[model samples]
Target: MDSFDSGGVRIAYIDVPAVGGSGDPVLLIHGFASNHAVNWVNTLWVRTLSQAGYRTVALDNRGHGESEKLYDPEAYGSEDMAGDAVGLLDHLGIGRADVMGYSMGGRIAAHIALDHPTRVRSALIGGLGMHLVEGRGLPAGIAEALEAPAGTPAPNPTAAAFRTFAEQTRSDLRALAACMRGSRQTLSRAEIAQIVVPVLVSVGTLDTVAGDGPGLAALMPNARALDLAGRDHSTAVGAKQHRDGVLAFLAARP
Candidate 1:
């Protein structure tokens, strides 16, 4: 584990080397409430990318994992999160890199691409879409579930994952909820079109969180879509189909 000061916040990260030799740097950003280890390393994402000759860096976002947690909802806004990624790059002396993110991380990646376009070479967004800004596309009961008490026990595997993620990150449920509400105000479908980098939008066929992958792909000028058949949100991360699709997309890019 390594730490860097990203705008006064201590950002935690892990850099994994490619198997054979160094390649274009790829930064992996985890979803909301998930740390670098849980979201990427534990899912074998580092190894998967390294095996394909890509150096990988996975960072724990502010308010999650070993990174500094600022309970202020204002600090957790998308702009701040995007700055953290750019900060990491500046600290590491990386001028540009490919970025891949899942869930909330995907949203942050979009901000990075749109706001800090020069720092991003390409983007891979998983488990999210522009529709989230609109209020009607999420899973049937997700909003209700998120609004439930922070300490409430989960009833199933999916819920269990969320609960565990929230607890592990020591996230302030109230602040996170506020941040979610605040994000809707800043997100825009028209802004998504401004990101000109090659993008790969992927989601499981059964993913409820992202709403629709094809819909998201259509919003980006240079984006491709992939569906991980038979897998849900959680299962798609390390699944063979998901990895193959992402790798194929990356390989096809110049």
Candidate 2:
């Protein structure tokens, strides 16, 4: 576990090289309000990928985990966070690697695929889908809820739940609030159509936050979509089928 300076921000990350066997390296970018451990490691992605013979790298985005807290909304856009991913690779001297991002991480991954396609060999986007084309994922009140007093009741239950989840994760409330606003950058249909890297978009069949995985995948030039049966956004992360799909996708490519 170590930290690197990304545009003056201290971004924390964990880089585990290949062991037992050797294969292509994969970079794992976590979802919003999530750290590397909770999003990837805790869910056995690191273990699975390592045992499957791939080097793994994961990072805590700017406002989450042990990374520097930036309360400025402008400091937390999808592209800026994407830069942090590239910064981690630069720090590790990695030229290009396969990438997988979940939820908010999915958006950042898309940004990287669009802006720095050469840096990514392939990408797997999960916990997201047509929402990337339609509208913002989270509600507007989530930021306000994060800024609310710890015990204050929120009119929006979804917002309150997120605030509670953030507190449970020991996140900086203000910074998370700023992140909510800043990371709302979504890809338009035209932007989605422009991504050239091979991609796999997986989503829970019941996930409301991520709409129409198949539709979104159809829009991308080189992408496929998979549906996890009986899963939702939070539950889809730990799904066995999702892992298989990712590994299969990577194997299907170079």
Candidate 3:
């Protein structure tokens, strides 16, 4: 594990060489409240991408993992988080590379692709979709649950859901609440339409959190969707079909 300071906050990350990978390097970004380990390495993504010939790079998106923690909502913004990813690339002297992200990370990936196209070769966006248009903010009270004093019950299902996930991952609940409040930036259709990099929008068929995957793909100039049949947002991450789609898409891109 390695880390670097971006602005005043320290961010944790890992960069592993693909022993025999012949494909373009891949930068892996994990989801909200989840670090590189729980979201990527433990899920076999690092090994999978590396074995397939991709030098894998991943990071804990500021408030998660061993990175610096900021509990104030103003301290974490989706654009700032996206900037963290770009900053990591800059720190490593990487001109550009393929970028892949899931869920909240997917939103950050979209920002990177749309706002920092020259720094991204292509994007593999999973667990996110047309909801990028329908809505982008965390459901009301979700953040509240994270910030609530320990032992206080969450006020809503949305809050409970995230609160439980945070507990499961042993995340800093306060930092996650701040993240939710600040990381809600979204791309308008016009913005997405301008992204030139080929994109693979994959989501579980049952993922309500992501909305319509195919619909989101239709909005992009160069994009496609991969359906993980019966998978939901949580289960889709480990689905073999998702892995196959990524490999096939990456292999087919120029």
Candidate 1 TM-score versus the reference = 0.87
Q: What is the C-alpha lDDT of each candidate?
A: 0.78, 0.90, 0.88
Relative to the true structure, candidate 2 has a C-alpha RMSD (angstroms) of 1.0
Candidate maximizing TM-score: 2
Model 3: lDDT to the true structure: 0.88
Roughly what TM-score does model 3 have, to 2 decimal places?
A: 0.96
Q: Where does the lowest 10-residue lDDT sum fall in candidate 1?
A: 135-144
Once superposed on the true structure, which residue ranges of model 1 sit more than 4 Å away at CA?
A: 130-161, 168-186
Cα RMSD (angstroms) for every candidate in the order listed: 3.1, 1.0, 1.4
- Candidate 1: what lDDT? 0.78
How do the residues 165-238 of candidate 1 rate in per-residue lDDT, one tens digit apiece?
A: 56666665554544454443345678878888999888888887677888877888999888889878778877
Clashing pairs in 1: none
Clashes of 3: 1
TM per candidate comes to 0.87, 0.97, 0.96
Runs in model 3 lying further than 4 Å from the true structure:
21-23, 136-138
Better of 2 and 3 by lDDT: 2
